[model samples]
Target: MSKYGLGSPLKVVKKPGETLTLSCRGSGSSFGCCSMHWIRQQAGKPLVWMGCVNSDSSGNDYSESFKSRTEIIRDNSKSMVYLKLSGLTAEDSAVYYCARNSL
Candidate 1:
C-alpha cells in the first residue's frame, strides 16, 4: 500500500457518459484570497494547466481544450471546489493538483 494510496488503492471511478464531480481543497489559508488552479500531470511528466477558479467571486477560466468539457465550480463557504468532467476516458487519467495563486 502506498502512503497516499496512489498505486495500491487508486480510487478511480469511471463516470463514462455521465458528469463526474471531483472535489478538491486548496493548499492555502482560508482567510486570504487564494485563487485555485487545476493542473494535470501524466506519467511523471510536466504538468499542464487545465483551468483556474477565483476564490473570491468570479467563476472559472479554462484552457481552449477544456472549453466545453470541463468546469470548476465551488462552494466558497466550505472552502472546496468541484471539478466536473463531462466526458471521461483513459487519457484523462492523471494526477490533478489544486494550487493557490495569490495576486
Candidate 2:
C-alpha cells in the first residue's frame, strides 16, 4: 500500500474536569510503521510540543510539564491512538493535535 495524508481527523472540546479523545486514521501499508503525536496550542500560537506516542515503537515521549498529567495509548489492531487527560482544568484548555506517522 501507498502512504498518504491522514484519512480522518478528529477534534474534542471539554470544560474543566471533562475528558476528550482525538482519533486519526492510518494508511493501510506495511512498508512504513505507524505512530501518533500529540501537540497543544494556546492563544493561537504554536505550542505543538505537548508529547508524542509512537504506536509502532511501543513507548511514549512527553514534554516535561505533561509527564505527570498526560498518557498516550495505542491500539494496533484498530490502528488507533488514544490521549487521555485527567483532572482537567482551565489551563488545560488548548487545541490538541494528533498525527500518524507512516515511517
Candidate 3:
C-alpha cells in the first residue's frame, strides 16, 4: 500500500428520505493519528464542508447545514471513518470526499 491512501466507492445511489452511510479507509503509519473530514461537490458548485471527527473520537464539528442530519464516526483500530447522512434528498446528490489533517 502507499504511504498514505484513502478509499471510497466511486459511485453511490440513494433516494429521498433514505439514509446513506459512506465509508473511507486509510492506510499508512499515520493514518489514524489525525482528524478525518468529509466534503462534497455538486455540479457547478464549489466543495461544501460536511463535518469531521477527531482522531480520538472525542469530538465532532459539522457545518450548520448538515449539523442535524449528518453523523461522523471513526474506527481507529480499522483505520476507517464513516459519514452517515439521514433524510437524504436530491440536494444530497454529489461527489463526496474524505480528507485528513495533521493534529
Candidate 4:
C-alpha cells in the first residue's frame, strides 16, 4: 500500500449538502505518472467510480450518480496531492478511497 497512501482512517460524518475532502501521498515516482481516481463503496456494495484526475492534470466525475454533485479540485500546495469533493448527500455515506491508475 506504500505505492500510494491515504492519511489515517477515514470516518466522515456530515449533514446532507456538505462537502468532503480527501488527501493522499505517494513516494517519489510512485504516483506522479498515474491517473488518480476517487471512488466510493457503501457497506455490502460495489465500488463506484466517482471521479478521476489524469496525470496531465485534467479530470472529471464519470458517475451519473455524481454528475453535477461532484467536484474534483487538485491541490499541489504540498508534495502530496489532494482532491476536494464537495456537495455531498446522505447517499454519499460510504467508504471513500483513492487509487492510482498505473494501467
lDDT of each: 0.66, 0.64, 0.85, 0.66
Error of 2 at 37 (Å): 0.9
TM-score of each: 0.75, 0.71, 0.90, 0.78
Stretches of candidate 3 exceeding 4 Å from the true structure: 1-9
The candidate maximizing lDDT is 3
Q: Each candidate: how many clashes?
A: 0, 0, 0, 0
Off by over 4 Å in 1: 1-10, 27-32
Can you rank all candidates by TM-score, best first?
Answer: 3, 4, 1, 2
Candidate 2: residue pairs that collide:
none
Give the Cα error of residue 88 in candidate 4, in Å. 2.3
What is the alpha-carbon lDDT for the whole of candidate 4?
Answer: 0.66
lDDT of 3 by residue, 1-103 (tens): 1112444357778889999998888877687788889998898999888999988999999999999999999999988898999999999999888888854
Q: Point to the candidate with the largest TM-score.
A: 3
Over the stretch 18-75, how does candidate 1's per-residue lDDT look in tens digits?
A: 7666676443355137666777777868888888777675768999987799988766
Runs of candidate 4 with Cα error greater than 4 angstroms are: 1-3, 75-79
TM-score of 3: 0.90
Least accurate stretch of 10 residues (summed lDDT) in model 4?
A: 72-81
Query: Model 2, range 1-103, lDDT digits (tens) per residue?
Result: 1223344444556787776665544546531365567777777676666666665656889889878778888776766666787768877777666665545
TM-score of 2: 0.71
